[model samples]
Target chain A: MRMIPAYPVRSVLVLLAPCLVLSLWLGMPSLVHPATPEEIGLKIATEASARDDGFGNFTATQAMVLRNKQGQESRRQLRVKVLEVTDDGDKSLMVFDEPRDVKGTALLTHAHKQEADDQWLYLPALKRVKRISSSNRSGSFMGSEFSYEDLSAPEVEKYTYRYLRDEPCGKLTCTVCERFPVDKKASGYSRQVVWQDKDELRTWKVEYYDRKDSHLKTLTIGNYTQHLDRYWRAGEMTMVNHLTGKSTVLNWAAYQFRTKLKERDFSKTGLKRAR
Target chain B: MRDGAARYALALTTIWLAASVLAVEAHAEIEFAAWELSGRVSLESRYFPRTGIDPSHQSSNTNGFVLEPKLYVEDVEGRSVTVLPFFRYDSADPVRTHWDLREAYVLLFGELGENEWEVRLGADRVFWGVTESQHLVDIVNQIDFLEHPNGKVKLGQPMVHVTWTADWGVLEFFGLPYHRPRIFPGQGGRLRFAGLLDNERVEYQSGAEEWHPDFAARYSHSFGPLDIGVSVFDGTSREATLVCVPPACNPREISDLSNVLIPYYAQIRQFGLDAQLTLGAWLFKLEAMHRSGERNALGLQQESNATELRGIGFEDILGLYREEEYVAAVVGGEYTFYSVFGSTADIGLLAEWNYDERGRQALPRRQPLTLDNDFFFGALLAFNDVESTEIKVAFLTDASRATRTLAAEFDRRLSDQWSLHVESSSILSMDPDDIQWVGRRDSFFEFHLEYNF
Candidate 1:
């Protein structure tokens, strides 16, 4: 202390105090080392979400193809309209177009950040709107391998994330992480391992673990296309069930953005008016 | 008379079509799409294990075929037209072999400055209620009884419906012009009464008869977790009160007293409220209604006091068309277990309590059939398989009447365009003194195969 200059020592400690506080706030291991796994995982997820902000609204068509263990195939088609909410989760209206039996059925959902979503169903045969419980998120969607929870928009508040490692995913370097659902009592999975590309933070694949920590299913997303030069969307998503040897493939088409959709377009009345 | 009613309906439809065409022509430069055609055909087979209480009604098996075709067109100007025609042919029951226009409507919906509005002019179906066991607030459409004993089917109602959406709630107003008479089973039909119902001698409390104009209004809104609706209806009652005039049923004689029951329609005013609250995995539903101007059991005594027709001691069928008031309610909840036992399937347990002020003493069809002071418990199993399979089983019991019924319904998709449905109901035990004792031998199993395009 006597050998060093007093002014230099005072200035260095003054600057290092804020850094030390910020590092601790961010849960970093040390100043010389990288951030802790939790910080890195959150950073990746937050950045990935930031990349998809301010889309306004969109409309798309999806054809779901389901295949059983014996190679039997069933098909369903639906049209989806989405509206972005500034301070909350998005709102969506999905209307079935194929599977003639339920042709005019529509589902409307208003997702929330820290609470259960609000859902309503329009039954064309009854010409009535029914408010449905959203707690059945783990149940299969339209008998497909994809559950309702899997199809919903993933908000950062719904899960807790942890970083695993950085590894090579195909030709691109990727960050592997794990996330546990916030609603542990309602979720069917204990945790999910995700692989996301480093450059654009595009999710490449996901593996789901059941409550008992057994591998349950794997989801692979491919054919990424960028819209508006800012948003990356997957054209194909395949979910395979390991326990039942069944799989469902969702083929998306006609991706449109900024469709001038309003909040009233996602209301209960809108559900009945959907074609 | 039936033919005349059909002609009147056709004339009204033609006039509406002409008016809509003129309206469309007034809108310049709006292109409409070509008419699209779609619909379904169904083949059904129903079997009864026990013979009917009436010896003459001996048909234990029957076959039916249905054809429903739809035509639709829409324009970019928020205008659309839908036409659906339905026809069915029953092998055993002549009344079941009938045809009707299920839907034929012109819908125009758009925004008015800051508000949204929709107008639908023509025949349509509107259903309102939250409870599953009994739809107390659903008073818009007339039930198609001959289509199913469960009364799930409805005939198209001719109306001019308008809906206005505001920041507060949605307000819907309906102007219904015509009433569809409830159809009954023929003598050969399994679910028919002890004798044939003479529809040719139908009576109405309103002098306007079947031509009486009806009005209904509903206001619905949704809060954070609750959706509620309040409705008011002023119209002819859909359920007919049967008046046995002369030569009433003798307790000793079990047959040959036909054409004595006259179906009477009453003008009524009904106020209803339905609400559903969703919390976590639980859904609570309530539907309550207060209706006036329908006959009750007490009216039977009033009839004997005023009319020349003496009461034949058949208290169930001899109620006079007197103005009476009553209240009914169905309160229930459903709790669902998602992915139980580590499977993708879901199971829901449902329980409902049905209450009627008139209780069991009220005549049949005055309130919900078989639901006066009753408890219903049910379980729904959704396989969530590739076939979209589902099964629902329910149990209904009335302690006062000592009656019990068990029913099961199953449906699955055979393919994208094909489906199959099966339903069975069994009356395990019933009190002979109960009004519904005639249905003791009415247990049946039904199968339906449908093809859609």
Candidate 2:
């Protein structure tokens, strides 16, 4: 009767306790030792920043194919020319290439906390550059399944996150996190839970929820390949709207970075003369 | 007019001959035009069991077809024009009559000074309401009352119209001189006319007829996301009736004419303002109108004619002057939910309240309560890339009764160029006591194959 249990819970705790303490200590480089979730999140954020800094600038060509349940299909091709990156891991201007009709389309994201991002679209048919209001970012982009909010650059400040667990995604270990959108007016989703590779920082999947707190859409990124010396980009991204029964797929290829693109290339005046 | 037609034909012949002579030289120039053809065929079969008035059973089946062909010619020497023509054939029964018509016209658009203008000289669909499915006051088309119970209005007359569009608004003027009557053929092969002057008891004088021109103006402005429009138009009367006609021995001689009295020279003048505003997920609309009819001269004439017919004095049929005015206002709103229950389920609720002032002399002064509520809920499910399903439910409630309709459709994409659709609709009423249903009660099913080019 005095024999120990086959799986001793006390021994398991003893083995995990020291490793947890050491992880906490390493996670908080700013401190000697820490145990809070925020400290680990900061460490993860720092690592993400470091990885983004190594990527510098990027330019790529992408093709998007959309298919409905009725076998209706639509395809579009776009060329992305990114200009600059900051130490905070923010991309400056990402320009488009052929089709010549949208050659001048550029997206500039000002990542900041407690403020809305400013955006603009230059329409060749109207021959005018119009400022896109921030309130409608959740609307569909050109009647596509992808929302304008999804197309915009994802800023860390736009969401508050909490690391959930370590899970296996394919052959790699992933960090699962639940993120809530800070700006209610700019997003139709109340929150999103995403899985990203721990070492590569490549996003694998995300589950989106509507304002009513219901599951709405799911996005999956796959077939990631190293674009530049340090940059890892996904070759295919698929987004599915659960309610609408619609899906959009984006396939990316031919990526290049840091070709000495100038700020003048992203100017409003230059946009009119892009083609 | 006959001589003018001959002259025009001769001139067209000369132009054709000249164009043929120059065809060889112009053969090197390649010209291309966009052409489109669309057609629709509808067949309906109905069986009504004996109810109330009818002792024996009655059933009817009808078939109709419409073909529309459009040719758009643009950038021809830097000019643009579009020609669209439509043909329709409708038959209800084998022994019943068949109606056919060529419906359409071409439009030539050009710039006059700084404003854009268009001249349309043939039968065409006129633009009036923003919502074509349900029109509150549009009265242009003479529709088949039996086939389309909701469309009791008349169609627009054939007219040559000129429209001018500017930054301010649009103005149109129509010149209509001829009145075409609808003819209905009975089983006995006798043709009967349907119009104001269709009765043989009336006589219409020749030279007394005059062309009536209708003029309308509309102005619209956009304030933020809201669009507001105000329109005014003049109501024109054109048809004249004859009371009676006597037999004539000589074919060329004029027959004996009976005294005719045209009923009420009703001239209706109307003005309306409509506004549509969108705020967030809600759409709000408001419409107000004031219609007044004056000059009851035809009523006076009818009284005098009746007195004469009865061999009475004019004083006996006096007291027939009763003018009427109508004022109505409606406000409606619709709210749409973009997402519901983690699905693309959209729900729209609409409520419209209308207040109308019935004519003072018209019967049924109680004026049925014009308040109505409509609700719609739709859901779409995509099973895969080749098949989809959609379901929609609509509920309409008025002061008289409440009706509910449910529709479901499944679409299967067979190929890149073809798709198959199956749809069904069912309707039911809320109140069993108010069961004088004029429309179809049984569900309807449709199978369609659609091809896109």
Please tell me which predicted candidate would have the highest lDDT against the true structure: 1
Candidate 1 on B1-453: residue-level lDDT in tens?
A: 144545666667667767876887897665886567878899998898998766575488899999998888887665788988788888988777887777888888778877788888888888898987767789888877778766668888888899988778899999988887777777677776324566666777788998899999999999889999999999898877766555643222223334445667788899999999999999999999999987653224333545444544334344444567999889999999887786778899999998888776555342224577888899999988878799999888885777888889999999999999999978778776554455578778999999988
**What does the lDDT read for residue A189 in candidate 1?**
89
TM-score of chain B of each: 0.92, 0.58
lDDT of 1: 0.81
DockQ for all models, in order?
0.66, 0.03
Q: Considering every candidate listed, which one attains the maximal DockQ? A: 1
lDDT of 2 by residue, B1-453 (tens): 112322332343344334433542365453444433333332333232222121121223234443434344433422223333323343532323232222333344456775656555444334333221134334232232222222322322444556666656555665543332322222221111111122212212223322234555556544544656676755542222112211211112212111222222234566867776756555577767666663322223334334333343222322344455666556776665543453433344555554446421121111111222333344444332222233433333344346455556666654434456666555544333221222333334545554422
**Mind giving the per-residue lDDT tens digits that candidate 1 earns over A1-275?**
58669889889999899987876765555455877777788877887887899988999999999999999998999999999888898999999977988888899999998889999999887787889999888889999989888899789888889999999999999999999998898677899999999999999899999889999999999999999998898999999999999999999999999985777788777787776
* Residue B190 lDDT (model 1): 74
True contacts kept of each: 0.83, 0.00
